[model samples]
Target chain A: MYVQRNRSLSIRSRRDPPANRHRFSISTFRGMQQPELSRKMGKMIKSENSAIGAYEAAGRERSSIAAQLSDWGESTDDDTVSDISDKLGVMLAEMGELEDVFAQNLEDYRGVLKQIRNMESSVQPSREQRQKVTDEISKLKYKDPTSARLETLEHELVRAEAQNLVAEAQLSNITRQKLKEAFDIHLAAVVERSEKQTIIARHARRLLTFIDDSPVVPGDARPAYDHETEARQVLEDAENDLRGWAPSVEPIPTSAGQESRVNGVEHDSDGLTTGLGSATGAGVSQPMTNGGPSAKKQLEEPQSQSQTEAEPIAY
Target chain B: MYVQRNRSLSIRSRRDPPANRHRFSISTFRGMQQPELSRKMGKMIKSENSAIGAYEAAGRERSSIAAQLSDWGESTDDDTVSDISDKLGVMLAEMGELEDVFAQNLEDYRGVLKQIRNMESSVQPSREQRQKVTDEISKLKYKDPTSARLETLEHELVRAEAQNLVAEAQLSNITRQKLKEAFDIHLAAVVERSEKQTIIARHARRLLTFIDDSPVVPGDARPAYDHETEARQVLEDAENDLRGWAPSVEPIPTSAGQESRVNGVEHDSDGLTTGLGSATGAGVSQPMTNGGPSAKKQLEEPQSQSQTEAEPIAY
Candidate 1:
């Protein structure tokens, strides 16, 4: 066998991109562009890989925080501290969801890649069949001194063409565009999910610091008011005043709202129960607010008030 | 065109993983176990894709925060607010670094995939050539296709075998294990980096809240006393006594460290101001220890004061 060891059924790419990748044509694969596409897609693959690792790490970090709460002597009987810890528990669960999403994102990415490999390999058998038919055609043309078989050779040519077409059809099965759609779609979702998750982590941090640095004792009888709630209301009222911005979700934290928020709050101020919300000072003054997205905007409390404010003061 | 339209070069997979994936036996390509492998690798690809999305999101989120800082009024002067704003700027820079790393990771992942596709495609030419040779040998068996032709056919079979060996060698160029190794290495690094970043975000949150909640006095000649500095040191010393741990880094925030922190502190306490360092307290504390890597451990403070303490007093 005079083996042509490197015959290929290659796809070509041009700068303009194929009009339709799945609809295979002679021009569909301009050359071999998977290398370039794969190289570009590599960033997506690596990013998802990072996310999986980060999600798992974040879960472990949150768990360590739970341990920290115990080590820091977070009085379990103190409703405020315990409340924050419970909310942290909820954030931890959200991290678990993020991990699952990350896993799915990875699967979808590799799934498309493996499909590409399989489709590319599909060319081998067709090329082999063509070679065999070509040889049969050649045999039919050869005479062993007397009998040449042109009919059989013509038949074999037909077979060869059929095999070639089969290979071409498989090439039509996928396009570069389709591969990106399959994989990159999930990537966008995961990215959005991750930023949301970081906010949850921020909430967890605020809750931890508030519980840790607070000097006020938990009220024995009366329900101690959390200034974060009142401040958020004031901010919402301010937002309505500033831009007529109606909050998409109600800003009020009902007792059930606090209990049921598995993913924590979109805003971090909900977790800050410290006098940071409403410090009355100098002349028992009020709060301060500057302009920005109220999500990150926080009001200033008078230092003189934060200084001598009653611990666990009612809003 | 009597095309066998749906003929497939499919790999057959039993539940038990086709013996070994790397052993390039003829049976290695049996029917095609691609669906199974694709199903498994899908997770990996999806994960990488998600990471890419998340890395971008994180970068964008950091940029938005920078915008928020500006919008919230980062004046050049106010030392306290501007100091926190400057630290936020450093964090934004770190986010940029993370985005770059994510891009590199994506490229590596896609590079491996493209290589795999290229290697798999290499099988086509050899298989086609072998088919042609086999047909030529068949033709040589005609009436006067004599012993001489048989000798030629025998030689051709040997060449076919050589081509088969080449195809097998091509198979060895890529293995499932190699793909995993190529893509998974960065995942570990990325994960560790993310958790470290969460801690960064935590510190950023604390600094922000500290600035936002404090009165906007640009320290007009009278030394500004931060109640938080006192409270945090007291907590640290309390923790030190509780764990019999000595402070590895000073908890007091020196303005010098702020001017100097290229990579922030190992412990948050080390970043606290010195004035809050030695607040005498009534100590009612007992120590607790737990076994773990203890990445954030502090060395012990003197235990003489922790035996009897008041609970929640102002500095």
Candidate 2:
């Protein structure tokens, strides 16, 4: 309800003009061109780029307004107004600088999101290859059950499945790890911006108090402003407070890639793992949650290494 | 220095491409058309409008990204990522809405600044009139010392000086009052936005902890996600914290027009004060700071009221 009251203060009754609602641009075309798997992330990243641009523009305009305020105050020729407005201008300019800094932090978060998008793009080809091999084998078998090429198609299917298995595992590993890492940077940035802006605004309010707004009568000159020293002191106090400010946010903890069983799973010369075929032949079934011990054992045994080397992926 | 390290994380080495630097629009033209006295405030107000627009655009983009994040998570077919990103989207959307509310608060502050600009516009004419009268009086006196029009010209000069005096006092009163009032709203809005966003981001980070990023080897699936309920609870907690949020800002105090000596000064039929001519004639001078008691005494006496009613200004 408090927020509702604030929103009601907008001079324009609408949120934005209807004509400006949809402006399809080059970025949307780029998002459409991305692989299906990475499309969503690509779009999100692009939208984030626009959001960062807005903040940068906002910061630039805010700093400009601060200078304008100081210039207007000097033109007034009232000593008190000039002194207080100039000091207030300094505080406002610092707030604009904070916006620029906040935008930079968001840029860091955006980079982490790009990693997720890149992983998504890399995983798409493996999925298509697996689907393609299965479809080909099914069509070939249905067309001729007596063909010698059936054996070759069957061999291709097995290799494709093995490669797909490795790809899926890598996908799962990277997706979860990068997702956590990205938001860790994002949420922390939010906290940092909030804390620093609050500090600047509180000190800026102190400058407003130095202004004496008691009205003067016509033909009666107001007393010469004696708060010049005090107004300057407020600016100094704001500077000191800003200099002493430090982040006070709780850090998010993560154990993303440490102690990874896949870290010990040996790969052949082509960076292809044969764990799927050999582990299945040995009937080395383990619960997904409790696979750590058996995986460690497999890491020690030399048999699993040779099996992976025998079935190098074709594509 | 600490902020410097964060800035280095930006993927783009440059701030923005040179092409996007300047874009001229109708607002700048409107600013240029304003009268000289109010031109600076006019431009500042226009710049603030653009800054508010930037924030609104940022908010819209942010909310879109939040939805995209949720959609991308669901497409991953990872239940853990789905639950967490959806809830994270909820928090991010709320942060976007905060930006909209902040822009509204800024519109209120911008309205207060307009009051000062309006007062400045109204005072400009009185300054020109006074200057014009003094110029004419000097020209006629120099051309003919004993001209018959000398008495009338001097009288007109006196009237112009009195009107300008009243206008100057009114300008001073309005300028200080509105400036203080405007920034009071502005700074408090900053504090409100900061405190609320911090609350949301802190709870959102808790959801990240629910994501299990431990890597899985090929041929071994990730364990079924067991933190669905915990992730859902994090969203509820964020909403509850936001609902309970309150403004935590120190109030800025102002005494703009209260105890105004000008408040008691009588105006003639045309709403013009004649205090200058008669206050001088009566030799009722007092220091501006100590004029309050004497002003109260003047209010009790009927003579000052009649004296103010004697001279009516032309324009």
Candidate 3:
């Protein structure tokens, strides 16, 4: 089958003259371009392949870590240090894998971008070629004398121009589609990889917490918290803030015909209010209109006083 | 104003005792019999709160790590030990927070389950009590004459039975609703947390990959591949399959007379073919009869093989 295909291709190539054979020559030129195109495509594919490989490797790393962690979870031993170390190692490995994939993807993106640039450069006409083509068309118009022949030539030119326009439009569309696909693929890969990182970070944080909460070896060289825990906490805090829960506050009362204001009076000159008398006497009656530092200070004074009084009661 | 509010609350408590008060007293009496129920609600609340806290903390940890890692990401420095250590520390801290929250939530869940059991025990009547009630009703029926007083007592009994039924149904409904709500909340939290974990894992993997690919310090530890990646890839592959991707053999040529045989062949292989291939080759002509594993495998094998070959050629 392969031999037959090659023979057919060779025969097809040699049967026609190079200049007169429009179909063969055009196709041959296209065929010749194929290898270069394939090479470029191959480079892109290779980069993508490597990126995917890195991605797979990273994924495997993460999965193994997950399995290990799960295994550790089921075990009865409290040798958290070893377990945590294993987890940390797994997390670190996973993180490294994620980074590898990310970097590879970036390289792939760059490769794609380079290919695009090359294609654009190759496709564009030089200034001299543009002028020559324009001049030739005009000269053809001047030389033609037979009205029918001129009309025919004009018709052919019009058709060619239309075809060229159509081809250009199609090419642009394809380019656009390819570009979009490339971008989308890159984005998807990045998102997927980033998401994995997030999981490792979370697990790592959990592991760290497990380690921290339990009593540590008296003179162990390990620090109080590991990198994973810190990273997890930071991410957690950011996420929490994003979800809107950094500070706790009582619901602001809203009532018709009553101006909403924070009540701030320091009758006791402390910062805390515990008993009903203090809460009602001045605190509830005096409403602070502003939320400036002075108001905050005033609020703090009463709270401090209240705290002093409350502390003794608590004791 | 606060004093007045307190006074009002006290008056209200005296007039129409707080539901919580009744609940508390009931809990105390039933504590020995149904200690679980008394603690369940509180435990559920506590668990929910802790889970939320853990989620928030994890988010924070991620953000902090992201910030720190961001710097490292841009740096071309080789000594990533310090950076790694720093990040590990953060992750550990975050993990600590997460574990604390998870532990709290787990405890709360246990408490809630205990409470549910307690409630179940409380709601059920002892066998002796049920017998006594049955006997009392029967006795009343026997003693009652065909008179106005007997009719009234019978009516009262009927009304009491109906009330009991309604109350029981309502209690069941309330319990069900509470359980559903608790489950939903817990499930949602679990899912959210799991997703976050996935994200962190993905990010961690990417980071790891990046580190692996990059020219970091020679002694710097390289991360390993884990199962998370495999699971994700498998999931993605399954999804793709669902979207539409499967292999099948071309059907055998059938003559007018052999149509019945063809139908039989289809019936036999119906179980082998999933929905994926059904949509694409719905009306295509077949060249073979029943497709066993070999035929199906033959058809399937080329796709992956061709894909592999085509990939390199494209690049």
Q: In model 1, how large is the Cα lDDT of residue B63?
A: 50
Instruction: State the weakest 10-residue window (summed lDDT) of model 3 chain A.
Output: A252-261
**Which 10 consecutive positions of candidate 3 chain B have the poorest summed lDDT?**
B1-10
Candidate 2 local lDDT, residue B13: 56
| Native contacts retained, all candidates in order | 0.00, 0.84, 0.00
DockQ, all models: 0.01, 0.42, 0.01
Per-model i-RMS in Å?
Answer: 27.6, 3.4, 30.8
| Comparison by TM-score, 1 against 2, better one | 2
lDDT of 2 by residue, B1-315 (tens): 001112132234534454765743333454335568887987788788788888888888888889988998899899999989999998898899898888888888888788777767767777888799789889988999899887776666665565566667777887887788889899989999999999999889888888777666666767888988887788788788888977666566655535334433333322212233332223233223332224333322343333332121110
lDDT of 2: 0.69
Residue B166 of model 2: what lDDT? 61
lDDT of residue A76 for candidate 3: 16
Q: Give per-model CA RMSD.
A: 35.9, 12.7, 35.6
